[model samples]
Target: MPQRRRNNRVAVSGATGFIGRALSNFLESNGYEVIRLKRQHFKSKKSQLRTLLKGCSVVINLAGAPIAARKWTPNYKKEILNSRINTTGVLVDAIKEMEPKPELFISASAVGIYDSYEVHDEFSTSYATDFLGTVCQAWEAEACKVQRIKDVRLCIVRLGVVLGNEGGAFPKMLRPFKLGLGAKLGDGHQVFPYIHLNDVLNAFWYIIQHETSSGIYNLVAPQMLSNLEITEAIKQRTKKSILPVIPEKILRMLLGEGANALLIGQKVVPDRLEKDGFTFEFPTIEAVLDDLIC
Candidate 1:
């Protein structure tokens, strides 16, 4: 892929995270100076944030605890919430202090902001009350506050499940199928919205470079498949059979509320991303699985 021009100096929070690392590397390789903002030990939050963001042309916020971490205990839940909220809060506060603010603010969000087990697009209004949905809602809400600062453009990307060979939801899923233990979860009717990692990176770059882009955009592929359909597709592509579906009740008993969030499904499509002229490299699950597995 050809790189974009290095016109913007970017500051990124959560630069060490999965998507963050990928985005930072892409930006740097493309000739942008990227600075990572880390939590300070002795320095106050404001001071450290201000120092890191000074003179930056853009700020990309991808900081958040992984939602898939096991057993969402009270402490873990608090950590999940604070990690995202505090990171955005810090960045927003810092931008407010900077004399000349960054032109673009790109923040991360998840498709979970919509109702679980239902189809949603950028225009979808149905939102779930589940923990994941609430987290995404709060995360995007905090990031939106950046718009209040004059001359700042805010873009919130509501991401779907990201598929990549390196690090993401794919390897863990492949483990079960590779071991022949993989089976469809729940009723297998829930829609699973997903996107290729490369597409995600491209979308970010496009939004950052296009001055007209702003507001909430769905970062997902055109194809939306059910849990069973995805399993079958993987099975066909990998030449493996996944029978004997995993019962939803059993998953609930084992994984609790988190299991419901995972096992249940949502059919989401990127109506806005496509309409805005962004293209997907892998639109179908079969294509995605073929590329990643092979």
Candidate 2:
């Protein structure tokens, strides 16, 4: 591991969200000064953002709506896009104005950017045309604009499902299994790319400390799981009775278009992260669930 940069000032947007909270705490614990950039901070002119971002060595952009929070109404979809794209655009503009800008800009994307059935990696161009995909594409485009600046290095991380005991999909996912209502969804064949929360935090640290790292990375574990495989692992830990498979139609009826984000899946590989030498602490579904489920 590279030596920690204790004196560096780091700025983070979405500092209150699941990933953001973890990242902020990690940075602080490592002796890095963290500046939490709230949504209100970006409301005024680009100058306001530039002032807020000044003197920071690194900036992490993780602001976005929870994709599975609600049914995809047209308005809600707009909220999703605007929240990510607009904020990213403002940040990029601000970075352009900074005299001595942050050295690195780490932004968020999702594996949903890829087409559902295909195997994808950082090099794959097979992208989805759905609402989620469109949102990620635009979000990334705004972040990539920072690349035009010669000094600032930009990294876009396309995250998979992040599992942890404290929050995120793990807690809600564990509920059904704990209630003895555990079952697979939609024949459970869809590939489920996942990474432990620890690895998520570490990936950010790895990128920040390693100045050579940039561009798109799939922040997922080495061993990808099928939905059924993950469900089975959860069941083993919970010792829950295996319930009937939940049909996709029922999920759609219940969750509306939001169900597509859950039911439809992607096989995303962390080709860049692995090739670049970032090792996962929990690399498999069994390892990830074992740590969180117990």
Candidate 3:
């Protein structure tokens, strides 16, 4: 573990979401003051989001609609885009309105910001027309506006699939595997870029304390494994058999265009985070599964 830095007051949006809740608790446990931004109520509008953020030195923006919570209906897609973009826009406006703006702004992004079919690093070119890609592009663009505020440090984290025991992909995957119904998807060739929940919490702390860190960093473990490899590992851990594989066409027919993004693979590595001296607690798929399963 790295040496702890000076404590600072931090404000977080989406404090109720999976990562948001975990990060808020982690920061509070580590002696940092955490303020949560909640939605406005008509009766007592005095609790404005800007007011809640007052005097905070760092702002961690994690507020966004859950992408996998629902089927990709057109209306839901609009809401998804609006939720991220609007929340970010509001945060930017609030910061601008603050008398003493936060010193550092750590915003959330997704690896989806890059082309889905190809691997991407911090310096990768933008490929913004795809569904998830466009959402991430807009979200990051909104966060970049904070740089215009003098003396403010802005960093964006492109997170991979977060694996945890609680509300995340892990639990859903675990259910089927535990029931002995688990199987690989779409030839099981798609890459699964993942990070342990503990590592993710530590990464946020590390970035917040390290003043020199800025720009986009991929918040993923060093290891990138294909879906088949992950399923096989899970089977080994659970003593289950590998069932029939779901073909890509079937998944596409069932999940629409978004299915391709899940079925296809990308071999992303966290080159920037590694160069920045951050170490992952679970750097391999087998290690991660062992921790999560057992």
| Highest lDDT against the true fold, candidate | 2
Give the Cα lDDT of each candidate.
0.82, 0.88, 0.82
Enumerate residue pairs that collide in model 1.
Answer: none
lDDT of 3 by residue, 91-169 (tens): 8878888868887899999887776567778888756467888789989999999888888899999998899997878
Off by over 4 Å in 3: 1-7, 41-47, 126-128
RMSD of each: 2.4, 1.5, 2.4
lDDT of 1 at 153: 91
Tens digits of per-residue lDDT for model 2, 1-294: 566543499999999999999999998998888999998887876777787788998989999888988778888888889999999988888888887888889999999999987789899989999888888998999999999998899999999999888778888889989999878999898888889999999999899998788899999999978899988888988888888798999888877888888888898899998888778899988888778876
Best by TM-score: 2
What shift in Å separates residue 78 of candidate 2 from its native position after superposition?
Answer: 0.7
- TM-scores across all candidates? 0.93, 0.96, 0.93
Q: Candidate 3, 30: how far from true, in Å?
A: 0.3
**Residue pairs in collision within model 3:** none
lDDT of 3 at 131: 86
Clash count, one per candidate: 0, 0, 0
Ranking by TM-score: 2, 1, 3
Better of 1 and 3 by TM-score: 1
